[model samples]
Target: MKIFKITGEFFLAVLKRTAFSFLDLMKIIVPVYTMMTILSYTPVIKFLADWLKPAMKIFGLPGESALALILGNFINLYAAIGVMPLLHLTPWQTTTIALMLLTSHSQLLETSVFFKLKTRAIFLLILRLSVAIMVGLLLALR
Candidate 1:
């Protein structure tokens, strides 16, 4: 079918792109990314996560989610996507958590990917989190 062909082509394109993109990313970002990774592993991440635990709990997620949020912020969504399977979130929980993660997902990296309206990304991301929190809190109340 046409749909199948299109899907197949899309996946092939993605594979090619991912392979090329990896090299490009490694060339440009690997050094900085490595340094950041080292910093992340050196207790700073845990310290910040601990500090933010209370605020994170308000959204029905625990501290681990905070780590995921931070990971998603600096690194990328790949890590968070891996963590999602382990969490085994329910449908409502998924929506709430997805909203929360998507709110500020990958601000450091992808923000520049937006050529125009760069500042709006942060504002929109915050708005997303707020709306997600309000909706999630209301649902939890009921």
Candidate 2:
């Protein structure tokens, strides 16, 4: 009976924490998703896409996947992932972006931590960003 009560309490706590996490993600995902959808209907998206295409071609990604890379680096990975579905990424493209972001996501947050550590944040930022790009290009070439 005691074990059963403990298990029940554990499940309840997990459920509560999970609900809050889901809500937090919804806050980021919903707004980004909505903004992307609205932009998709405008010439703004096409313009942005056209402008980015040359650079994004280096990673074999569609121009709009640039949004995901930017968001992941500056904001967080969740915000980036939110836009990917609308981008219609190929499996290879998705893998490239995922690899890139894995190396360099949440740059602002990490840079602040480096500052707090009295470390050279700019050097670290350059290193991470360059490594991400190199990894992306390597995968894109495969």
Candidate 3:
């Protein structure tokens, strides 16, 4: 009976922690997704698309793909994925974007983690961003 009580308490604690973590993630994802969706319907997206077109061309991606990159970097990969289909990306473009995000997604959250661990947050941020850009450019060459 004591063992059963301990097991039940442990499971309950795990469940509660998981739920809180999910809510924390949702707080970031939902707002970013909502803003991206709203931006898709406005001229702001077009302006950003046009502004980023030249840089995106270097990565063989459409200008609109900038939103995914921004969201993936600042928010999370899920936020990037939420915005991807709206851009109508080609397979290669999608692959390039995925690679970039995989290399350096969730900048703010990850940076905080680095800081908590007594690591150099800015150095890691720069390194990750640089590596992501280089990998993206190389993938574009293929």
Q: Clash totals for all models, in order? A: 0, 0, 0
Model 3 agreement with the true structure over 14-76: per-residue lDDT tens digits:
999999988877776677778878887889999999999999999999998998999899878
Candidate achieving higher lDDT, 1 or 3: 3
- The lDDT of model 1 is 0.63
Give a tens-digit lDDT track for model 1, residues 62-133.
554665565656666555654554444667666666666665567666666652655676666566556756
lDDT of 2: 0.93
Clashing pairs in 2: none
Root-mean-square deviation of candidate 1: 6.3
- What TM-score does each of the candidates earn? 0.50, 0.93, 0.76
lDDT per model, in order?
A: 0.63, 0.93, 0.90
Question: Which of the two, 1 or 3, has more TM-score?
Answer: 3
Q: Is candidate 2 or candidate 3 better by lDDT?
A: 2
Off by over 4 Å in 3: 1-34
Please give the ranking of all candidate structures by TM-score, highest first, separated by commas.
2, 3, 1
**lDDT at position 21, candidate 3:** 86
